[model samples]
Target: MEITYTEAVILYCLKQLKGERTIFSLYHLYQGKKSSQTIQDAHLYHLTPFFQAFPFISREELARQIERMEKKSLLDKKSNEHFILTSTGDLKLGEYFQANTLPPKYLDGWRHHHLTALFWERLSILVQVCSNLVYQKKSFIPIQNKLETLDWVKAFIKKRQEGRMGLSSTLFLELLNCFQRDKTIDPSILVLRLTGQDRIGLTSGQAAELLGMDHTRYQLEFLNILHFLIGTVSDEAVEFPLLNALIPEAEKPVPFTLSTEKTFQLLNRGYTVEQISRIRNLKRSTIEDHIVEIALHIKNFDLAAYVPKDKEKRILEAAKETSAKKLKLIREYAEDASYFEIRLVLARNGDQKWK
Candidate 1:
């Protein structure tokens, strides 16, 4: 049987989304990959709302698409956990990968689409959150107990920003209004709600109090309404930031190279963070971070052989000079956290620092 252009393209998209089960699952469901009890549930409960968030297709249409994809063998229907791509799907995906290099616009700006979806997904849960808060407020005593209101708010924020839900601006404003009416609401709670930095969404009573109310049902309901608002219909278009949260005080940069280098060196030596902390005179968390940077640089260029020899030498030397003298100037402008201190250091040293 001859494959149509649309079917081929759909197959290609499926292959491109190889490992992201949620994404492929949505595509599979839309393509009509298979019809089973589990697939039905995934479609009705998970994929449907997810698609609604993007305003891409109706729930019924999505299921139909999944069935179609299954008939074509582009998507494997047997697995409940993930949508495994078939050989035909792989070949189609390879065709697109080779023939169509992504435009710079997509490469650079695709992140924004993802970030926006994540924001909206979280916002969807705000209504449920407020409804619950209202429930507690009306009930006289807190429904969740010493469980601070801020904690629930934090968890919801984390869930939404984490790209686990569809957030919306309307929901955001509603939440703000809730806090306004309840002046007792802490600003930290609001901060946690937006940034997902702290604990905000702890549940009432459970072994894992952290579980809180699994807002999946709440998310599903608001997901439909939000899709109409954002003006999209498919889960594919839904996007959120992969790394969209603030770094904590512990993550702040320290000003020394040997400290950075040694921390990394110890970590590479297979030392646990705690071991590294004890061995090196730095905090365990700080040592663990050094491991990350060291791994990044090594992955980019060989650190052991390159250090004090080639490109790595020049880079480190520059970093050190910048660290020792130039960095001191930026310390005064501490309030300007967004600015890069490395650049400030380089600017101060001018030609003297680069050698």
Candidate 2:
């Protein structure tokens, strides 16, 4: 029997994890946990693209999926929770992938997760509105009902320099340009889900069935196209100007959690982790998480303030020598490095891949 898309994702994560972590690590990774450790795991395991790829999944659902894999001999349980992929499992995973079963190509859950859904919301509403306005029709239900999104759309349309005809044409051209630039993208995945004028868009399940895909398969494909558009429009704004304007400006700079942003502002004024903890009335460990999260996103963020340069170098060296990301393992090689110091270095190394 063919493995399902969800199973493939689990199998791929298991392979990347290399039996070092428990199956639940994949669970948290898929959920896109906001914790520092979960964020670090995403990069350390080279699973950044798949991070938060399945936020709707429940722990019970994950347990069921793992049970299914075990039944298929794709996974062998070790110590109750940890699992190592069996040879048959590895072979199956390879075969499944060889069929071009739609593994993620441009997911980028790390960079674009926060904005992907929002962009699609704005685009969907804009498309529906433009479709009706160009035809001189009024009084239609909006595709998005969130008050914030509704307000944003109204503001967006009012700010547009194009008339209904010009807006529709430019939007069409910009969208066409985005898909054409990414030759691998299949626009039909998006078009099939989009609604316009009198035509209501298909529900995700409806679209998936129509395209001969499982709902999960269609979700992954749709995310790929969405992220690709976000990346393309961001990088080549001059090319997709109309679409570029749709990107949320507030989130344009950084995608920090609200609490992390609060810490970031204090950090800008030079608060020590301890001081930030005191100021925020949170534990020191919690503040440390904020610091690590900062290092993960802000590439130029200074670490010398937290970890000595020599120590940072040693931690990174140990990481390279062992080819291991687990703090306990790297600690053995860098005997003098503290776990916090090791984490600080790894956070940067995970992204930069420094030698």
Candidate 3:
């Protein structure tokens, strides 16, 4: 018998379904079981909800379909509540499924696609070049070898806009800073910024500023995009594990005696100020203060010996300049790192650590 697409779809869902009830629910009461007085009630109860959501199949209609199938020997009626498809049914269903699906060539990207891997691998190069455009809030005018980079930027933006990218607005805005203007940053440069000594990961709030949207809206939008990027189509909700990795775990403030050592250890372990607060039962603001103070001390310590002195000096200078205005300049700088980089020079410095 020729298998219909509808039949194939039903079979696939049935095979993949978990739990006895769900399986029993999807399948029509085939076997002589539904005719039995004892099992008939159970079949009707399970069948009701399924029918409502499905093609609104009536019990009479389903019985007729089952009878037809059985007559054709496509299904075997075992007991009152149980029915099994014959070997022909299995073969026909498999054939229909295979016929409906495209060849492997059409699914080439699916075999190796992972959003986090794609983002991390592409980000360093993409963000560095796009930083300029982001800072300028201007579209990339492709020239030189910048076309590929701009194309990537366009694609990334499109994905975000379509809710197919799981990035937060804070992250989106942070990303925009990299491509804001005509800045042609190398991927290595952006990578360095993320991995630098004075490194701080982008926050959800900061990401909101980047997208020019309110934090709450951006957060929802970002989560949806993440869902799309992660390829989830479940009726039940799922969270991406990569999100936890994106931001460090929150950390509590340590006293000065243990601050430096502890901060270094936590930073290496991906602990954020917020994480620290929860861990230490301290306030977030207090933890931030401790982290800032410790960071400053690290900058002051001839740990300059461990780093490139000139680059360190330049970074210190930029921080000093940004700090002078403090609030406004800091916000501006954070909002547009590509623009801030010229005046700031430390735009992509954090990425260096990964190298």
Candidate 4:
């Protein structure tokens, strides 16, 4: 069965999350939700970067798609807020992969990698240098102004030229072949146009104009192409040394604050939130916040200890009805629900408005 891009993305997200996920969590992963903290506080949740900029789909539209998929038996509602891929859904997802010439496992793994601002910065610089080198240009301005990044690129190009380590024309041809198989025109052109061949490549701005698109939109398309290329090549890194070399080695630190770590340690030791609050000299609300953050990041964290399953249902219902981010408003609808339970529901559901 054919699926829209949004449907495909949803199926892909559910598949990646191991075939079960709350709508909130799925949404968070799709759009790359960030933690509430400004300075990397303990309650902050680490988020993986996603291709949110290119897509015009909204949460409401996503919810509608989920409902439609469920009705079509492509998805099974495991609970009020959680969903799983049905056997039919799995088959449909498989079809999607086959149609796109993509490997499901690799796409899933790509979703988990932390694509940071620095990764994109390095990617832009690398693309520029590689493009110049491909065209046999002796000198060109680096995309990045940073000396360290320029030095790294220079060394990397030198190594490649010296036949030490780098991508070859054969690899570029393979990449182009892959791009040619894609449904969109921009992806192939973006790849070829960005990596110059016997001619200096166009800058992103020039490419955007040439493609009759705004610079920002063109950049988003460019990023989407780059992201797909990186993910696909990384999946076969053993065979594609050049693509593998471009993979960023820097790891993002776990999304836990020192205080949250203490809270998690205490909770693991069977300490109640109230007990931990007093022991740690922090407020009960603060401790609860830590638990919420923990639940958001750590899938195995036991939310049942704080909010019962029945209460969870009520919180979800209230949240859906009101669509309010404020704790006070949510509490009005879920009268018996404590602030902690409400927060837990919102966090698990990946509601960023409250945060």
* TM-score of each model, paired residue for residue: 0.24, 0.93, 0.23, 0.54
Q: Over the stretch 186-207, how does candidate 4's per-residue lDDT look in tens digits?
A: 5543643543334455777788
Q: Which stretches of candidate 4 lie above 4 Å from their native place? A: 1-34, 37-116, 127-140, 154-166, 188-204, 234-241, 249-287, 320-329, 351-355
State the lDDT of candidate 3 residue by residue for 154-268, as single tens digits: 5665545423233433445543443342242222222332421223335556656765644433433433333233232111122333222222211212123354356556655
> Candidate 1 at 80: error in angstroms?
23
Q: Is candidate 2 or candidate 4 better by TM-score?
A: 2
> Clash totals for all models, in order?
43, 0, 51, 2
Model 1 residue-pair collision total: 43
lDDT-wise, the better of 1 and 4 is: 4
Arrange candidates by TM-score, descending.
2, 4, 1, 3
- Local accuracy of candidate 1 as per-residue lDDT tens digits, 121-212: 33423444444443343222222323434364456566664232334453454335434543532333223223221224332122122233
Q: Which stretches of candidate 1 lie over 4 Å from their true place?
A: 1-87, 92-129, 132-137, 140-355
Mind sharing the TM-score for model 2?
Answer: 0.93
What digit string (tens of lDDT, one per residue) describes model 2 on residues 1-355?
6778878878888877777788888889888888788888888778888777888988899899899899988899976788888888888789988876535788888778888888899999999999999889988989899999989888888888878999999999989877877687789899987889899999888989989987888888988898888988888887877898888462375478789999999999988888889999999888888888888888899999989998888888888887777789999988888788888888887865433
Name every residue pair that clashes in candidate 4: 24-349, 42-257
Span of ten consecutive residues with least summed lDDT in model 1: 102-111
Best by TM-score: 2
Every model: Cα RMSD to truth = 19.2, 2.1, 27.3, 10.6
TM-score for model 1? Answer: 0.24
Candidate 2 residue spans exceeding 4 A from truth: 101-103, 352-355
